[model samples]
Target: MTEIVRARGLVKRFDGLLAVDGIDFSIREGECFGLLGPNGAGKTSTIRMITCVSPVTAGQLRVNGMDVTTDRRRIKATLGVVPQDENLDPDLSVAQNLAVYARYFDIPAAVARARSDEILELFQLTEKRDETVDNLSGGMKRRLIVARALINEPKILVLDEPTTGLDPQARHLVWRKLRKLREQGITTLLTTHYMEEAAHLCDRLVVMHLGHILAEGSPQDLIERHVGGQVLELRIESDGDHADALAALRDRADLRLEDVDEAVYAYSTDQNWDPVMRDVASFGKAARLRESTLEDVFLQLTGRGLDE
Candidate 1:
């Protein structure tokens, strides 16, 4: 596959603080790539550099084979960005907002109007095309932002928390539109805190933390390699001497133990959890089984829960 975006030893700094510490990665043509991380983890800084809104402090960064510093105009023309916060023009109508945004690229007035019409229909906002941006709901505003981004028909789309504050139905709508863009062969770069969003949409992802890459792989591969397969959750009356009880279950050598907030978590590769239950049964019946998830992987990797 051809690499559409490549960064080697990329670094960014704000005053004396490092926002993005030397990181390297690439996005292949037509692939959905994700930067998964919590806030202040350098994901936004990386995106800003990639979009040419901010210059890299060090290392080589290329998009569509053009160096960002030297080819700012070309890169900007080829890229579309949806920032985490909506920056729609409140005074303008939805259709006017798209039209004015497209004009920034020097699009013909007739062409901009046509594009706005088509995009409004695509976003299911044709009925509200004449409505002022400030009157629209949060979800409507997000969809309008996406439609405006697509007005340029950019080869690369970069979204930062595209569904951050939307309702479930609105989020799914955005997902469906994104899937359509993928089918059309647009390379997508996404940065989001929602793990399930990354798992469902991204072809591959890198987990970022503390301005560095923590792990890189497919969602399932990361879960299996880092979080184990099946997990036995025990909410005991009291975990007094639970380590001794856990030691008795050494017959299953594949399991790893974790104790969190009065709950004991037994992780194993094998799906059969009978042996673990039997061992914990000696203590009490409060133990239960839970399927492993990417949340578990995130928690294990960062030593804290994703929401924390």
Candidate 2:
């Protein structure tokens, strides 16, 4: 695979606090790679260092084969970044924001105008092209930010929490756009707390926790390796005495179990739903079983929900 982004022992520190401890990873060209972690996991700090907005305190970092320290300007020109926050110029009209950013790349007026026009239409922002940025809705502004990132026709795209606050429809729309970009072979590196988003968009990902690498692989590979392919969630109400039954079932299946407030989770790769159902049923109607999801694996591994 072609290497687009590479980092070795990357580290960052602020006020003597190690925000991003030594971590190493790489991104292949034309692939959508993910950085999955909860808040304060150093994902953002790593991005800032790789993007050259902040200096790395230790180790080597490269983007598009250029050294971040010596080739900062050149690397910046070849990359596009969309921060988690919307940093749009509120005073400018929607189209003008892209126009201005295009100019930052030293793109000529006529060409920049054409590119802006094409992207506005591409993002379905043509209808709002004349509206002030502050007047646009959150989703619209987000689409605009993505459109602006493409103004440079970058070789790699970096998105931090791209769909954090979007409604379902808007989130799906963004996913469609990203899929199109993947089809066009633009390498993308994304950081998000949403497990579903990572599973849907990332071909491979690295899970980070407390500035350390926990696991790395394709979403399906991680699930099959770290988390089983199938899971059975059971909620039982046994008048405050549920440990014995839960422990018996957990050992019988030889599965990992998680004890939440009112339920115990069982996970296994085997495709025998009947056994899982029967096991729960043996505990009486107090047990309820349901299929597992990516959300379950994330919580199981991280000990915290994605939204938390």
| CA lDDT scores, all candidates in order | 0.87, 0.85
Candidate 2 worst ten-residue window by lDDT: 285-294
Off by over 4 Å in 2: 238-241, 269-276, 283-291, 305-308
lDDT of 2 by residue, 1-308 (tens): 98899999998899987888899999999999999888988899988988899998999999999999899899999988999999999999998999899999999989999998998898999999999999999999999999999999999999999999999999999999998998999999999989999989999899888787778888888787765777766666764446755755665655777777777777766556676677567667556555455666667677754533
The alpha-carbon deviation from the true structure for residue 21 of candidate 1, after best TM-score superposition, in angstroms, is 1.2
Q: Residue 280 in candidate 2 has what lDDT?
A: 62
Q: In every candidate, how many clashes are there? A: 0, 0
Every model's TM-score: 0.92, 0.93
lDDT value for candidate 2?
Answer: 0.85
Question: Which residue window of length 10 is worst by lDDT in model 1?
Answer: 236-245
List all candidate RMSDs to the true structure. 2.3, 2.1
What is candidate 1's lDDT per residue for 153-266, written digit by digit as tens?
899999999999899999999999999889999999999989889988999889888789899888888888886676777764545655654566545667787777666677
Model 2 clash pairs are none
